[model samples]
Target: MFDSSKRQIGFAPPSIDNECIAAVERVLRSGWITSGPELKAFENDLETYLKSPRVLCFSSWTTACELALRWFGVGPGDDVLIPAMTYAATANIVLHCGARPVMVDIDPIERVVTLEKLQAAWTPQTKAVMPVDLGGWPVDYKAIGNWLNSAPIRERFQATSAVQETFGRPLFISDAAHSFGAHIENMPVGTQADITGFSFHAVKNLTTAEGGALSFSLPSSLDLEQTTAWFRSMSLHGQSKSALEKTQSGTWQYDVVEAGYKCNMTDIQAAIGRSQLRNYPDHLNRRKEIAAQYTKALETVPWCTLPVLKDATRESAYHLFSIRINRFQSAQRDALMARLKEDGIATNVHFIPLPLLSLHRNRGEHMRHYPESEACFNEQLSLPIHLHLDDEDVTWIVERLCYHVGELMTPHA
Candidate 1:
């Protein structure tokens, strides 16, 4: 049933309420806007949300990841395993750190890296592995942790940083841009990995317009305060004093202890994030509710294979509601999306596997070895699942989708 009213259905969009607007306004009127109190409070709020020791906000998740790798001493001649079924940023950070990214395949069902695949991809040079939490569905860290605990793998780890020396194993970094506010087996995502990076991109479940944050979970043997300070310095051009600290009366002295990247979050962005965090529980719940609505309507559609929403072991943030049409090829998938566009609906694909991208392909990453990733790319489609979508919007999107799917699935007579 095509929309008769010319109603337009968009993909995910940010929810900017009046409260979010006022938050930005407050920051603007504060005079001192850059890296001020708002950003500090937002980091504190994120620290509380993740229940992790340290939370450092950044300009983007990409920088947050690169900085983490750098802090852990991942550099030239090292290898970092990244999931093939994810946005390039997951692997790109490894490249930016001057480490070779070993693109690995994922489990077909979960659309995320698994222990078996990781084991097969591991090499003596492997320094770390960044597991991605695709579409907000939490990765099974318990299984992954078991894989890391083995003596054989642990012995291969080369400790570079003071903190890495404590772990005695390759770092497990979670590229959890989609999984913020997500939990696995009752534990939050930030607690599941050695380091976790979250996205607050404009299109994410929670937006700071364009910002991200990192959470730390070092072994108890390491000093949390010392390590947190080190990361803060690394994000601010390795300066001894932050802009906020330097502003204090008669305290303008600072030094560039080491070369570092500039990736600090802005106060304006933090203000929006702070507002979003204030009602995060409700925001997260609304996303879950919308996911339930989609699942109930599309469950019986044979061609549609819904993404992993939640189970006993994990609860997703529901950032994206991606579906795999069981019988559709890439050509058919494109045609269905085109049909929906004609009906005033906008749809999109979650990702094109890294091996399929030119950067990785030129680096000798071949798609032939990643059959599961290729299969996912050919059939997957992301439907609208933001809080902005009302019941009518969702109902219409599903109806239009089913109609297009039927037309494509039916044998040409």
Candidate 2:
């Protein structure tokens, strides 16, 4: 137990320390800040960490993934399969590309979209599929991949651009924003998808404050060097030469190849990410411990349905400790959260299903269509699981949760 006045446990706060500050200070003193050597080095480090062939950093996941949509030519009249349970960015990016986000319902237990749902939703106009790893639990990537490569499905794919025509199949882009360090079959999440985008927002496990990265494992038909250059150039207004390249003597002149978006990661951000990556494995371990503590304490509770952290083939990154209060509707769940807040503890819901949002609703998407997503949303409660917490804090949170839930479920005056 904690003194309410003295304890204020924030939900998913950034775990910045003296070392992280020092790294930023060094970058600040370096004089060159934007998209320079530090960014390149960070990408290389991420490549090694993720076991990816190559990785690229950008301002955020939305931009990096939207660029992928643009690069793959996902425009109007095309359909991109996505889960209704994901964050807005997943569907918003599809809409930004002038394509329809064919939202699919999640599996009741997995809380992630399945190959069957995607297959059922597929159409000749479906140009791509962007599945999210909701709450760090990866969707069935192998099953989805096998489906994409099946001869019957491949024959139905309609290629509207050169990039699409090359593979003769719909693109598989993973919305791995919350699953950066998660694994499937002992392999990291990045290599499984054709292109996997990772978010490094302040709350993420391996944050760059406000940054994201993409790891590519595109089909061999595409030229890696050329594709890498395309993304790099696009991130910087489609310029023929980078600021670093033009710094060479008598290399000032350059050409603008195409109108592009400006969403490059700066050196300062990279410095923070580099510092964090050095001890990421240890950070991951501590997070796992915290998750285990919660699971061990609550697994026996009749009303609690603990989130899956590991199984035979997949392991979560432990980004969020989202547990379900069985049979609790939105009102009771919110009341439990209120009780936790009164104790100076913070909690959150991972997301409101896409269909429930005004933007998606106006677009003709309805919450009723995604029964599993709505049901999951009603009971989902994401407990604080950050490095800022120690064993005692976790135990305290569990105690408060148990008490509040019991009170809510009990009949009282």
Candidate 3:
């Protein structure tokens, strides 16, 4: 048995090094640490990497989601569909705008908001469908787009629908916080949906301490420049010019265009983001290798269920290597976690289904209908899978996990 006093493996830690430190130092020395040149360079690099026309950085993913909803006109009386298993931020943004969040069950296999669930949940008030790329797996965007483009179905479902009638069509706003580099059919995640938001939290594949970005695929009828300008204004307290703009020579003039929230990413964060973006492809490859190793190590266990892998046309960023303990009760799952802790291995759960939480439950969201999410919550565990983990660490983690499973499977003590 492993000693509990030994140095414990961390679940996930920011993989920052000299590059990130140097970038931060440069920002501090530049005297333009706020949203300035570094922010612009980061945004440009992100746009090029994601192959999108526009990308706007924000302080966090929550703010990005809220701003996307606001700019896309998802406001009072609107209904935004989201997965029941995702982080609360996905639905909280909809609520922040006075809109209703219509929770949908995820696909059991993929653990993501699927087209079938979205179609089933479509209602007269449905304004937008937000599909979360859960655990870095990209959702089926082509299927969603095809469903939305069906003329007969759109006419039947779109007309008289509150959100659709108000916006002229149902919008697809993706919560892609977990999937910065994921792709589907060779198309990047950010550009798959009409509007997509990416998270660059410290624990993500790409880190900026804390940041997010929004990208869009504008409709032919909408003006991209105008939309981008409107979102930029909304991000900066609805002011025509930001602090950086006012500091420029002879540019000390601006106007308050509207009442909006303040949530802009500063140059200090963007400086780190630029370096991370440059190395993201390699980071993704390493993550994929780790995931493959986990699968190879754990698949033989009869009680283990591996995370979904990429098929012919879909690919994942491998952000999380989640495994479910088949036939394990909630108590058994808890015991396994405790045993892993004793063995100096760290583990985590991706999320607790939103409906089970006190805030949501108090708001009348019951957990009885979200069986898939509940089942996953009871049995799933996220293993360590970051750049920080080495081969020996991964092997030790797998061995400890297997030992615990073997113990749980034995006859009552």
TM-scores for every predicted model: 0.97, 0.98, 0.95
lDDT of 1 at 196: 88
Q: Local distance difference test, per candidate?
A: 0.87, 0.92, 0.85
Candidate no. 3 TM-score: 0.95
Q: Higher lDDT: candidate 1 or 2? A: 2
State the lDDT of candidate 2 residue by residue for 1-413, as single tens digits: 44646789999888888998998999899888888999999999999999999999999999999999999999999999999998999998999989999999998888889999999999999999899998899998999998998999898888889999897999999999999889998888999989999999888899998999999999999999999999999999999888888897999988997998899999999999999999998999999999999989998998899888899999999999999998899999999999899998999997899999999999998998899999999999999998999888888899889999988889988
**182-284 in candidate 3: lDDT tens per residue?**
9888878888788898888888889898999998886666778887887788889999988998998999999996997888999999999998888889889
How many clashing residue pairs appear in each of the predictions shown? 0, 0, 0
Clashes of 2: 0
Q: lDDT (0-100) at residue 90 of candidate 2?
A: 94
The most accurate candidate by lDDT is 2
How many backbone clashes can be found in candidate 3? 0
List candidate 3 stretches off by more than 4 Å. Answer: 1-7, 156-167
Which pairs clash inside model 1? none
